[model samples]
Target: MPPFSLMRCGAYLIPLVNSPLAVAQTTHLPEIEVRGPRDSSIGSADSASEGAAERESFQSRPKLRPGDIVEAVPGVVATQHSGDGKANQYFLRGFNLDHGTDFAVTVDGMPVNMPTHGHGQGFADLNFLTPELVSGVRYRKGPYFADSGDFSLAGSASLDYLSALPAPIVDVSFGSHNFRRLLAAGSRTVADQTWLGAIELEGNDGPWQVPEQLRKANAVLRYSQGSSARGLSLTGMAYQSRWNSTDQVPQRLIDSGEISRFGSMNPTDGGRTRRLSLSGKWFDKGRDGETQISAYAMDYRFDLFSDFTYFLRNPVDGDQFEQTDRRRAFGAQGSRSMPNRIGGLDGLLSVGAQWRGDRIGEVGLYDTVARERLSTLRNDKVSQDLVSIYAQQFVNFSDHWRGYVGWRSDALRYDVQGRALAYGSLNSGKGHDAITSPKLGLAFTVTPQHELYLNAGGGFHSNDVRGATITIDPQSGLPAERVPALVKGRGAELGWRFQPNDDLTATVALWELGLDSELVYVGDAGSTEPGRASRRRGLEATLRWKVVSHWRLEADAALSRGRFRGEAPEGEGDHVDNAVERVFAAGVTYIGGPWTASLRLRYMGPRALDTLNTVRSRATALLNFGARYAVNEHLTLGLDVFNLAGRKGNDIEYFYASCTAGEVASGACGGGIDDRHVHPMEPRSARVSARWTF
Candidate 1:
């Protein structure tokens, strides 16, 4: 029996057995200390032991890029290989991360959406955030807080820089994929005044065969003094990361989870940006109150080649693609928290308001073919402006319980010139839409060693007012128009936590979510239609224990099912690529004299190919192993290997498709017809890294 066949058999057989794999609690964990001072484990794979077991536990150190982040996360999927590592996209909450701009992204309280964007993921360039530089990542499913207003559909990713540390520090790393990393930060503390500065860089040829390459750099600086000094502070951060590749690779065959694709898929895509922020804080003594205000702005540009025609054999027949975009933003926020007795309960009230707007362009500046450029965006200039107001209050319902509620309203305006194309007398105009989002949660401690909780929240996203005119139905001959559709997200969860023994703790949670205006495939290049509400409901459970000194273990698993609610007719490209069935994770840690090691395993069920919407995966399980040694109190060495046991993992494919015809396109091609199958993951790649304290 071959490994793939065995895996297929286990997929069906394992469910029959309640106890598929035995897992114990954890006592000691591999401490891969991150930006924080404590030697705590970093990375999403090394989730913390708090909260819900598997479904929504706070995971740290998750991969930062689209491929690594979305691939490992549950309830999300992506398209596979495009030759030379080009055309990498993700199916997030069932939508393509393709255009880049649609899915909202933010870093340290700043938006990444561009001023103008088509109906895809091109504008949302998260590659700028290097995974290693990230101290921690918090992925909140469904609707989140108002501060994250830009994107709340597929949840959100919150990134933070190192906090509460000295002004100066340095870090460097070297790994597989021809990877190298460097970080340097300087800070000064003079009594009540403090100063900080830092720089970071990550470069790699990317070890994968796609022959892709990446380079990233970042800088940060801050200055602050005592409260009397205008209660003001200055902090700024900037980043630039680029991806270079040949484009798409076509897939042809698969066996034992490894795929063989022939033909070439080629293209090029990447982005760059700069951001800055300034804030003020004031504490009132007469009445207990804390307030903060912020002013911020960002300028970014993205360049891409999504035209698969680049590899159509005949240079004239190929579609050369490129979109140059620049986006800018300015905004302000004010909030006040006051301590008081609300209905005999001690709590606080917070409220604020803000306004923002952007000028965007979808210009087809240059392309290999002139006709393709004109057909793409000959007369494309769409801009949007928005203003909003919101308020939230936190209250203590009882000694062991707390709750919060919030509401917001928004107004919008849009501009465009149907010059390149045609529009019925529809002129640039303003529109208004508003919704009140609310959140409520409770925490209960039944006993000193046990706790229970529940939470429910709502969020909204109206379709882009700009994309309504990309391409009218090629079949209908009707004028192509992109209309903004109102979208909403709602979720509820119940959970419990228990500590039966000193060294063991466990968490169990049940959750369900609904998202409106889902992007359903409409069949055609750069085209899609909004579907009704989709439901994401599932169960998550985890068990962790420290059986004894020097030995620790943890187990976690999640089962989610997502689908269109009305049983709507399935189109050629209609599919749910989220982790519909199961995702399992387990880890073991061993600490010995002068040496420590840990082993981790992750199992993911199959998914549908985003493009053709076919269920094709054969199911896969990936194993990762890591070990480290202490050279002394001041230094340590370690080896970490992803895909241990040399298991060749398959590709889930990001949600978009495009091709290129660069010089390196020959070796990059794989599948024939859009090469649905991507090459398997590398057999086994390992990295040795270390750190020292002075």
Candidate 2:
């Protein structure tokens, strides 16, 4: 039997099990251990937009929230609109991926994106993640990989956790705004098996007229044995959180001094959530092939109170609402890969299958007043099932040319049971949908230091089940048109990578993506909002240079244009709403002896708030600084400053109709007022931490 081998295939690790005699005929082999950070993906990546970041890279940056770790990916940004407990608003390329609509995230082989969620279609909350336990993050952009399926039209990310830590660690942190955190982690070996355990506790009172009293707790445990060639691991995780939310406020009110920038019209808006999961993975290497399998089960609960439009509907009761979701999910995935000859050329063939099912006990929306339910607008139970199969062929066509050709197919089923409503018997139905996607990638190695890549693929994102089978609108008993269960998309990219030496590397890419329809199912309203077909084209570039032995510089930038495909609607234009136009980020780090210091800056360009492009958001820039010093072999001190310049900006903005109490009392709220709703960015803050190792 040959030693186990693994290779990267998109966001997945393809197991290259067996080796030919020509390469494994050695009679004696010496044990080798590799260490140090992987600063570049010169020879391991197939496309310019695909890369992996080690724990050392992101752990050194200043993060305001746990989700900020994702920002380490070039051309990506993560911001918040509500409380810290909620999912972070993500933007990539030119799309505003609200709560991860077109992005897929996974941790330890367990999917994080919840389909048919209560708050959004694909809600992905990362508050449960503990950054210190992360081993690495692998990310890929575009739909040119068969290993990724739904919610991957824009990109996908997978975070891996360490099986064992070098030593026990305890950390304590304190910051402004009443922020505090404590974390502890350790690992022990017994009976040839390793046991790892970690726990975290955090709390914060955000800067708002109505403080966001956020409290959160998280824990993880794992047992593992064997090496990379053959291994088995079982992990369990638990998390719980609660907080008060200060959603976006009207800009007009702030400008008129009727309300402060951090003031909330509804102080009773907040949410509570909890999750428990058990997951296991196993892999084996054999003479003929290799096999990998993983399975997971999860229990989840959520309750949220929100008021996006304060008093727009009911003047006396206010426009507050509550959304609830309780569910259980189970999933399994497996893959097999083997070395095979294709047309007399060396090649590897891989096949994989995935299955997931979600049993939702109750997912509902209700009218509320001051955190109390006034009436049930919609209540239902749902069951969703997904099955996917994919195959890929990787071949070394020649000494300098290689590529992969792959295909994937997915099938979904939805079953909903609804309670009778005041208007009629609506929101109950069964539907099924299936789609097939093809992927192609070609790469040419011009020299040891340069490469060119071309890729194209087909992909799709599933819509909410409620929208697919809706017959009558719950709010107005009027007939409604059913939307497709799944929307299709296509993308292509041309990329180049240059790495003249070990100290410097650069990559550039031109990409385009198109969607059949931009329709979105609004979970808050329990209705589907219609939209026209759309297209996005963009250019992205990234560079990483080790200026000297102790200094490193990194930078990335993107420019994108998005528009509707055809003629505009009566009031809409060609411009895509909330489509980010430009993004630039740069960072420098110095690591020498016992001191490590870093400085980073990020710039986000203005975006259109509406289709007409008359309403736009202001561009903003933010800077952060961090430094750490090793006081001794057993202790370390660190400091981080966020919003170092104290610059004022908006984290998010939307143009919509909302009413105020004064306007309603004066009979001026005929149909509410159309204005810009903005969520201001957090003010300057600092945190200091001390860590002890044993």
Pick by lDDT: which candidate is best? 2
Which parts of model 2 have CA positions greater than 4 angstroms off?
A: 1-43, 519-530
Q: What is the C-alpha RMSD of each candidate to the true structure, in Å?
A: 11.7, 8.3
- Candidate 1: Cα lDDT at 670: 39
Q: How would you encode candidate 1's per-residue C-alpha lDDT over 547-572 as one tens digit per residue? A: 88877777767776676666556554
Q: What TM-score should be assigned to candidate 2?
A: 0.93
- Provide the lowest-lDDT 10-residue window in model 2: 10-19
Model 1 score (lDDT)? 0.50
Candidate 2: give its CA RMSD in angstroms.
8.3
Per-residue lDDT value at 48 in model 2: 84
Against the reference, the lDDT scores of all candidates come to 0.50, 0.84
The per-prediction tally of clashing pairs is 58, 0
